[model samples]
Target chain A: MEKLLDIKNLHAKVGDKEILKGLNLSVNPGEVHVIMGPNGAGKSTLANVIFSHPEYQKTKGSIVFKGQDITNKKTNEIAKLGIFMSFQQPEEIAGISVFNFIKTAKNKLSGAPVDFFELKDEIAENMNALSMQENMQNRDLNVGFSGGEKKKNEILQMLELKPTLAILDETDSGLDVDAIKTVSNGINMFLNSDRALIIITHSTKILEKLDNYFVHVLVDGKIVHTGDKSLADEIDKHGYSTFKGK
Target chain B: MAKTQLEELNRNIYDFKNPDDYSFKAKGGLSREIVEDISRRKNEPKWMLDIRLKALETYNKLSLPTWGPDLSELNMDEISTYVQPKTEMKDKWEDVPSEIKNTFDKLGIPEAEKQYLAGVGAQYDSEVVYHSIKADLLKKGVIYTDMESAVREYPDLVREYFTKCVPLFEHKFIALHYAVWSGGSFVYVPSGVELDQPLQSYFRLNSPESGQFEHTLIIVDKGAKLHFIEGCSAPKYNKVNLHAGCVELFVKEGAYLRYSTIENWSKNMLNLNTKKAIIEKNGKVDWVSGSFGSKISMLYPMSILKGENAKTEYTGISFAGANQNLDTGFKVVHAAKNTSSVVNSRSISKNGGIATYRALVKILPEATNSKCSVSCDGLMLDSLSKSDTIPVNDVQTSDAEFSHEAKVGKISEKAIFYLMSRGLSEDDAKAMIVRGFASPVSKELPLEYAVEMNRLINLELEGAIG
Candidate 1:
């Protein structure tokens, strides 16, 4: 399998403390990779490093996206180059309608004018696909949206941007089982032959609809183990205690 | 000198007296002769000069403003009342001298005029250097010109509501403004005329230790609608630069007007500005303002709902960084039955800066069935910064509904942790949170303007020291 996103010996820290130490991961196109780790295992830090979050310092390693060394690119710039991260806690932008917010993000990605009818159709299709009501599109972006609703809105954004590689950082953390299923379905629909996904999670609930290509276990800021889909199930059953106190 | 000194805010409009070599400035303080000289410099009509002198006398007789932000530090005697950038206003950019035109270039006036604005009138110092509008707007019976031209062409109409809504004697600053007012915008939208785009005026003060008093008067006739935006900025200078401009708006029956302003003045500014609107039956007035920089500011945009079903909405936000005391808010008066008002104010104070939200929502006896709601929220970035909410509600009617709620808080640690846990950098998390807190004000703007607001919020969050 060809690598779409490659992280080689990545070391990143936030405010004087290292979180991702020598973490290595490679994801291929059309692959749905799950990273299961204990608390403080640098699971999300890897995602931010890949997406180029401003806070994470790349002290020791490199991240190559599509053969380009984009280790320190801005989040918006990385997003423009076909990488999207569904924030764990999506920001609530009041006074900016959902329609306009998504429209802006989409415009930035496409670098062109958005056709009103096509834009409306695409927004409606994604909202309906995620079971979001029509009224949610007109309200301020995540202003009054519930937890599950915000997660759904994030997926709606993911579906609209149609990025080549998506790093869903706990997209289902605060969701109920039913909502998790709906959000998983939204992610599942985007798993095309040209698309790849990296979902950071310790729980296996969001895996109901996603078919796994690989599962990596991160312990103490390093990917200590790599295995098949059953690794997630094993971790969920035995708990992160298996990798703890190492 | 007819300037009120409000000293509670540890502020003044002056510090550095001589930063550069310049001329054309008047002595500080206000008097009848001062007003006459100002009118004489502009070559005003006899009638207009009379009004200026009258306003000056009224200013002398009126006491200092006792309400709202303090002005004790605004020394009228020390302020150079007027600094002329251009000898006369010009319609073409090139015809304007290079120095004055260069100032506008530095301020990005021509670029903004081309990209976003339908028309633009730029005031360099105390005088307008350039004024021009798209020919189409003029053909549509929309009048957009400088106040000086309006006096010569439409004196009767201009005088009818010039000081009718906001009289000169209302406050000391206003009286001084009327007396020393130089170049400002005069907009008249005819009935049923809807301007497809926005008209804007950009004021840039380049003179050090000088004052810029420009009057902006807008009248939207019945069933008409317009959106006028104002952008003002002065570069960092050591001296005091005063901005005591006044804006009076008349929204006629069934008409609507949305006024937007972004004040990015330097910390040397003692912004003693005033704005008010009178909305008639079935009319609406919307005020969208953002104050980003000032040393000390006392500004309150008021809306008086004088007819049944008239409404007003004020969405504003202020940001005060280190060594600044910014006092800004809005007021609404429900005068007639069924009139309504909604005011939402937010402020962010950091680096020991003081951010205040002061507002008055009044319901008169005749304003039955009227509803007024005011919500103020403040965000303090650190322990040193301070935020205050002072709201006054005077309800004289029994059938009115008014509610006021305020919340002042520090940045949420839980929110930061959640965002960081989701792979957002801590800085990104905080920036996003601050933008979210100011989202109400940003969202009220158009697309480009909203993006500008976000950029401002991001910039202010960079040096946010704990």
Candidate 2:
């Protein structure tokens, strides 16, 4: 299998505090990687560091994506290389409509102008699948949106942009059962032979709908164990206490 | 990563110039003799001439403002009080001088008139060179013409409302404005007349070392409604230029007036403009303004709710980029019972620019049950830029409700990261955030004006981030 993402002994920090210490992971195309960790286990930090967020300083080690070193790359350059991360909490960007934001993102990723009508039709189709109102596209991005709606909007962006590697950081946290079902459906629609997904979540309720995934147990800034799909179930049943202090 | 080329955003698109071609030019300096020369050359009546002399005396007595941005660099003695264009005011576009018409063409004024406006007025240098109103509006008894013509034809109406809202003694620049004010628009919407389309006026100052102090007087009569759009631009010059224009609006009982202005003056221009509206019983006035270019600007459009249940709303945004200091805001005075006012102001400062929001809200004792809400949001693009909000609220009535909120900060690093992670470059992310910051004010403008304002914002954001 072709490796889509590889992190080798990644050490990162935000401000003065180091978060990710010698964390290593490898993601292959056509696979789902579940990252389950207790609080402060550097789960979200791994995602941010992979996307090269400016606030997260990669002090040591290297991150190679598709065999290219991107340790010092800017967030935008990394994003342009087909990596997308859904925030645990998306910022409210006033005055930018959801439709405009997605359209700009698609254009930037593809480096081509988008046909408005075609893009509109595609967004409408995906929004319908996500149970989002058509008027939601006209509203400011994530502003005044309910928590569930924000999560659904993130999934909608993922579906529209069709990035090769999608890092969903706690995307299922604030969602209701129905929203989770719809978001899972959207994620399944984005699944294909050429794409990879790294879903960082605490619960296995969302992972139950998918099949053939590798689950990694992260603790205190490093991954302690890796197993098949059963690992997620074991963690959900036993919690991270069994893996703590390892 | 390829670094985005930081192009110089200071290229002035309106920096085209014509040779010092003029039919008349007042001698450099501010004096009674120069004022008389301006008034006499226009063949003004005695009362108008006397008003000019009185204004000249007031201008001499008044000193530069002690607060706000410094005006010490502005030497009044070096500025020509007036400069009349070579062409006479023509109602027909074909009759306008080709050179002057070409300038308006370059600014897209003629095309905008054809597409959007019910009437169009083009002012070059210090005089309005062209003025025209649609036949339909004329048939509906709407009077739209130059201020000079209004003073000549409707002397009674002009005498009653001229300087009533913003008097010459209101400030030092207004005094200077009244002393040498030459050409502007005079609009009078008759009672119960609601025009379907907006009327527009475009001002272009082409002369160096000259001032364009055109007066705009608009009165929406009882139960009538009107929307007036004003645009101003000047070419860059080495010498200093001054624009101290005045706008006075009278919204009568049960009437509404929406006044919008986009001022993009040259960086060498000191834009000390004043505007005010007196709203009567149940009347409403909405002021939408965008200030983009100017070396130093101090503009605060005010509203006086003089009648019971009067209403006023002001939405404005200012962009001060590189070597610019813009002190802009809105003021409201609630003098009658049950009056209300809403103000939303935004400012963006980048590349060592300074932007300040200075606002005032006063609810008099008689204004029982009045309500006032003011919000000021400022965005600083870099550490070298500065943004300040100074709001004063004076409430004398216990029954009144007043609220003021202000926020000043730089773009969030997380927000930038979020946008960048969506495949946008850092520069693009910053520009998008800035545009979003100004969207509240721009969304209130007409579609064309909103697009123009966005374009101005984009141009100002170029090279804003390293």
> Highest TM-score among the candidates is held by which one?
2
Each model's lDDT comes to 0.82, 0.91
What's the lDDT for residue A141 in model 2? 94
**Range of the 10 consecutive residues with the lowest summed lDDT in candidate 2 chain A:** A106-115
Across B163-217, the per-residue lDDT of candidate 2 in tens digits comes to: 7888888888898999899899999999999988999999999999999999999
Tens-digit lDDT track for model 1 on B220-265?
9999999999988886677677899999999999999999998878
Worst 10 residues of 2 chain B by lDDT: B1-10
Which 10-residue window of candidate 1 chain B scores lowest in summed lDDT?
A: B1-10
- In model 1, pairs of residues that clash are B5-B71, B5-B72, B6-B71, B6-B72, B7-B72, B13-B240, B14-B240, B16-B239
Poorly placed runs, candidate 1 (over 4 Å):
A1-141, A151-246, B1-23, B45-70, B111-118, B134-141, B414-429
Give one clash count per candidate, in the order shown: 8, 0
Candidate whose lDDT is highest: 2
Backbone steric clashes in candidate 2, count: 0
Per-model TM values vs. the true structure: 0.74, 0.96
